[model samples]
Target: MSVIVGVATLTVVATGFSPHTAERETVHWSYQGSTGPEHWAGLSEDFAACGAGREQSPIDLPEDTAVGTSSDEAITIDYHPVTAKLVNNGHTVQANVSPGSRIIIDGTPYELQQFHFHLPSEHTEDGEHTAMEMHFVHADEAGDLAVVGVLMEKERGDSAFTDLWDRLPTEEGDEAQINEPFDLAEFLPNDRDQYQYDGSLTTPPCTEGLKWIVLDDPVSVTPSQVAAYREVFHRSNRPTQPLNDRVLTLVED
Candidate 1:
C-alpha cells in the first residue's frame, strides 16, 4: 500500500483532525482557556460548525436509550501490522498510519489515515468518563469520514502501547518514526460490539456527517502509560455534545 509522508506542500481533506503540516501553522485552537473547544467557532470563520452544528460528536451512550441491533450490522475492521509515524501535533499525539488498513461499512471501504489519543475519554457511557480515548480516523474515496472510538481504562500493564508510549514526542511539531511494523488490532478489545451514531469532528471545523462507531468494551492501559501521554498533552478532549434527535444504535456481536 502507498503512503504519503510530510511533503512541503500537500492538501489533506476530510480525514478528521489530521491537519496537514502547512494547515497546522494557521489553525491555533487548543483544549483549554481562551482558545479552547468552547471558543473554537469564534476563533475562526472556518470553524463555524464547532458551535452551530447540531450533529456533533462525543455524545453520551446511555444503553437504555439506544436502538438494539445484531452483530450483523457491525462495521468490519481490516487493520493489520504497518509502519506508523507518531506525531505530537500540539493538540494530541497522533499516529499517521501507512496504507492497507481499512474498515468496511455497508460494503464501502474507508482507509485508515490515522489514529489519535484524547485524554479522559470524550464519549461517555452512562455519563461516566474513562482514562482516555483513541480515535481511528478513516476516509472513503469521496472524502467522507468515519471514526472508530475505543475507550481506555486504567489497568496494571498493557504492552500494546509500549512502542508508542516509549517513543512519544514531548514537544509540539515533533515526531517519532516507527520503522518496524506493528498491528493496530492489538489496541482493540476482544469484543466487537459497538455503539453507532451520526456525529461530527470533535475539533475545529467540526464537520458533520461522520459515522461514529464507538466500541462498547473499554480497552486496558496502564496508569503510567496514561500518565506518560498526559505529560505531553496535559488534556486533549472535547466534552460530550448533545445527541439531539439522532438515535444511538447498539450493535452487539
Candidate 2:
C-alpha cells in the first residue's frame, strides 16, 4: 500500500465556525501555562467551543457508567500494511496514512486520515491515566470526524511500532519517510471492545459532534519505548473535558 502526505481538500467545518480560520488566527497555543487548554477559547473567537462546548473529548471512562451493547455493534477496522509518512507536527508525532484504510461504524465508513500520540495518555479509566495514548483520526464523506483512541501501558515492548520508534523525529517541523510497509492493524490490541461516545476535538478550536471510540484494553509498550517518544515531546495532552449529558456505550466484541 502507498500512503500520500498532503493537505486534505475537505475541511472539518463546524456549524457556524471554521477550524481553519482559528488555526490561521491563533498559531501559538501550547500545553502549559497561560496558553494551555484552559485559555484556548479565549485565544481566538473561532475556538469558542474549547471552553463552551458541552460534549468535549478525553473524558474519563467509568466502567459502571457505561451501558453495555452486543458484539454486533462493534466497529470494523480495515487497516492494512502501507508505506506512510511520519512528521513531528509541533504538538505531537503523527503518521499521515495512505488512502483505502477505514473503519466501518454502524455501516458508515470513515476513511483514515492520520494517527498521532499523546504522552501519559489523555483519557483516563476510572480516573487512572495510562502510559500513553494513540489516536487514529478518520473522516467520513461529509468531513465529519471519528477518532479511535488506544491506551498504552508500560510493560513488554510491542514490535508493531519498531519501525515508527526508530524514525521518531526529534524536532518540531521535522519529518521522516517511512518506506517500509507498516501494518497499522497489528499495532492495535487484539480485543476490539470500545467505549463509544459523541464528543469534540481535544485540541484547539475544540470542534464538536465527533464520534469517539476508545478501546477498553490497553496495548503494552516498553518503558524505553515510552521514553523514546517522550524525548521528542515532554508532554502533549489535553485535560479531560466534561461528559455533560452524553451517554457512553460499551460496544463489546
Candidate 3:
C-alpha cells in the first residue's frame, strides 16, 4: 500500500482506514465481537499487519525511565485557526481540521491532518489508565505518519470538546459540519516532555513504521465531557500491546 499524504490538508481517520491505505479505501471491521480487533487479521489477507506486526502500539510506558532530550526529535507546531468537521465513524468521533495547520519536527514539516479520541486512554503509565486520549495524526508529503498524543484526565468546569460533543453523529458513516472556530494549538500541554516510540497504528490494518510521540503531560477535561464521550464510545481504546523489546524514550522538559 503506497500512502500519499498532503502538505497541510484535512485528513480524518475513517473507520478501518490506515495512513498506509489508499484514499478511497473502505475496510470492514469493528471494535468488538466476530470482527473485532482480536480477530482482525483473519478478516482479510491485507490485514496481516494487525496480527503479525512486530512494532505494534498502545504500549504501557515502562516504569523507571531516564530523561533525555534530542534536538533532532524536537516538535515545533505551527497550527492555525481552521474550520472543523465532525464525523462519527462508528468506532469514534473524529474531527477534521481545515488546511493551514502544520507541525515541523526537526525541520521536516508535517501537515496537521485530523484528530480522534479513545476512551480510558490507550497507552498507560505503568499500567495506569487516564480518562481519555486524543491522537493528532500528521503526515509528510511522502505519507510518513507521525502522531502526537495528549492524554485527558477527568476534572471540573467545562472543556474545549463541548462544541464537538454537541454535534456528534450518532449513526455510522454520518458526518456534520462544525461551525465553531477550532484552534489546534489549544490542545498542547504546557509541559512539552514526551515519550517517543516506533509503533503501528492502534486500529486494524495496524500499519507499522509510523512515528508516535505521546506527551507525558496531560490536559484536563470536565466530568461532563467524559460522560458525553462515554455515551458515544464507552471503550474505544485498544488494549495495550506488548512493548516487545521496543525502547521508549522519555523526552525531558
| Candidate achieving the largest TM-score | 1
Model number with the top lDDT: 1
Q: Which tens-of-lDDT digit does each residue in 1-253 have in candidate 1? A: 0111121111223225543332533556667777777887897787889899999988999999999998899999999998988886666778888999999999999999899898889999999999999999998988788899999998895457877788887876689999999989999999989999999988777878899999999999898998887777677788999999998999997
Clashes of each: 0, 1, 0
Off by over 4 Å in 2: 1-26
CA deviation > 4 Å runs, candidate 3: 1-20, 23-27, 70-72
lDDT of 2: 0.79
TM-score, every prediction: 0.91, 0.90, 0.87
Model 1 is weakest, by summed lDDT over 10 consecutive residues, at: 1-10
Over 1-253, each residue of candidate 2 has an lDDT whose tens digit, in order, gives 0111122111222111232342233245766666777887887686799988999988999999899999998899999877777776667778877788999988999988788888889999999999999998888888788899999888974556776888887776678888877788877999999999999787767888989999999988789888888777677788898888999999888
Candidate 1 displacement at residue 133 in angstroms: 0.4
Please list the C-alpha lDDT of all candidates, in the order they appear.
0.82, 0.79, 0.75
Clashing pairs in 2: 3-98
Write model 3 residue lDDT over 1-253, tens digit each, in one string.
1111111111225532354554543545655666666876886686788888889988888648634667456677678878878887667778778888887876788887788888889889988989999998888888888888899989887677666677877664679997767777677787888888899888766878888889888888889888877776657777888877778888764
After superposition of all CA atoms, the RMSD between model 1 and the true structure is 5.5
RMSD of each: 5.5, 5.8, 6.2
> Which 10 residues in a row give candidate 3 its minimum summed lDDT?
1-10
TM-score of 1: 0.91
